[model samples]
Target: MTQISAGERDRADTLASRRDKFILPDGVIYLDGNSLGPVSHTAISRINHAVTHEWAAGLVRSWNSAGWMDLPITLGNRLAPLIGAPADTVIVTDTLTILIAKLLANALALRPDRHVIVTDSDNFHSDFYIADGVAAATRRDITVRRTTRAALAEALDDDVAVVLLTHVDYRTGELLDMADMSALVHAHGALMIWDLAHSTGAVPLHVHEHGADFAAGCGYKYLNGGPGAPAFAYVAPQWLDSLTNFLPGWLGHARPFDFEPTFEKAPGIRALVTSSPSVVGLSALAGALDVFEGISLDVLRRKSLALTDFFITEVEERLPGVFELVTPREHHRRASQVSWRHDEAYGIVQALIARGVIGDFRAPNIARFGFTPLYLSFRDVDVAVSHLVEVMHHREYDDPAFRQKNPVT
Candidate 1:
């Protein structure tokens, strides 16, 4: 790996101009966008307006006047293009966990005869947990089976009802082939569910185009909504009239205000709404998404690849054999982030953060750095790697303070 010309690359980056839209902290090279995207100026403005004007003045009237009641679908439509999904198929609703539960259950409902759900060991923990929980809830002898990505095809069988896989490996930043996987699952006659938590805004996706039966992802990562930002779920329009909403709320009722004794499903994307939309969070997310309105995923992907490639190059040159590069080197098989494996990855992450380079540590031994093309510049990547070089070379992380574990980490 060899470093690219940072000065030249930054001048040529088309997305570099968009960095002004975000309100990143001064003096911090935020490489943790894969975990939690920082707030943008538009997001802040939207949040302020929602707090001061919408909620404070309109009160309950905001549901109708401010379009709060429709945010779940509206925001969903806003995010659809990022994933190459059709407008009516996506809905920003609930947390990723809740959405995962709903999506997996919905797929299971469509395959009652199948007794097994297939997922890889590398899938997000929440996804596996939800799959296991849904299997347990079935009470009809259903089981959740886990395996490696390489064996996903072998894991699938006539008994497999649904297959859930993360588009990007959360810890290793490995990108999976959505089209290939979806086709394989379909060949086996099982519905495919994609957990897009790590790839939603970080990579170019064709969720609906790739024939994914269902999908879910977070809003706080590369999408840049604030912490605790709402998550989204996607249901193929083909199942609009048939998919079951396991956690139905009044909003999902066909005639929400009808208040009928029996539950009636709403039409289209509204069918996925489980409860009232988070007005403030949606407001923030809508504002945050403003920066992405006219952006091209192709352009974004190119910038991401360059940044990661450069970072990996600089690391290999400066740090030598200090850490093992765990993220895939193949551009087609990598996400917008990079990770290195080290025994003291946690301490290394802490040391970098103390120096104002904010990356994150995944469990076990992974130090992760996310590169967001929308706001991150080549200079940012260069500076972050420079700090990492210093931290490792100086043995600054040898201090006991850097080794202490936080509850969150």
Candidate 2:
């Protein structure tokens, strides 16, 4: 609980020299990358080229000549290493909700006799909502178990057809043991569909190595594909021929361009796709991923841990009793963010943003701060803590006018 010195902070800032790749605003310490990442310079340029050259000039030919059509699977291949999935097993496509529904239906098709879709009650709202739809559509029961890892293990019974869970808790940044949970699910004869929204870029993952049957995640959050970026899905290659596509649109047909009369599933990752790729967004994502071409997740994890640990310690030293930590203290059980429970979380978040230290607010009283190793520095974390201390001690967060609700928190 000690404040790091300005000299030490300066050294940390120097270490963040590589952050020049991002187009961050001056004097702003962005700590909401967990929700939507800041646009990178490379992403911007890539989008520009796609817009001007690929779309405007090339037009329809771009789909083949410019390789616009191959982006979904191509980008998926690029993303494979990040998620620890084999090549041709992942595909950049529709939103996580849509992908979840498709994968859930596909899994249900495989187990016609099973009626229960097991998931954690604390899983992200979208996942729960989709599970509800699956129940209604198939006349199957959805069993939501709101419990800890230990309890979850007990909940995975033979009746469970699929075990759905988020790799990291969106609210508290709590991480789950994928390997352990997969083993438990397999023992119960259930398939696992992991929501990698908070795990993909924040931590190292090995879906195939851990035997994950299915997975989905957002592109905008950690992949930095801008708002409404195309999400990706991972289906084990073993299910390539057997798994059915609930939304077997022309894009997923064996010969999409052929415009066949019957719905024939395409082979490999192509079969998982549902529609035309988002060229602009995918272009941006492809360029954004280039920033990590040779980067090691080990180095990224080390920096992430240092940043979160530094913020927590400095906050405790400067603003004790003002807020209570909601995120886990154990490094292994944590993600890339830190959260604190406070009565005036919304107002505090607004005040922090006004001061140019832009974090975010979650529901019910949680102030969240995300630290992206690519753009955030130790100095930024130090400055953010200083601003936080000022807001609390100077009563700057007591404003009644700044408490208006925002749609995109």
Best by TM-score: 1
TM per prediction: 0.98, 0.96
Count steric clashes of candidate 1: 0
Residue-by-residue lDDT tens digits, candidate 1, 222-327? 9999898999988888988787788888999989888888888898878878898888998989999999988889999999999998898889888889999999
Which candidate has the top score in lDDT?
1
* Poorest lDDT segment (10 consecutive residues) of candidate 2: 6-15
Error of 2 at 50 (Å): 0.6
Shift in Å, residue 176, candidate 1? 0.2
lDDT of 1 at 128: 81
Output the lDDT of residue 132, model 1. 88
For candidate 1, give the lDDT.
0.90
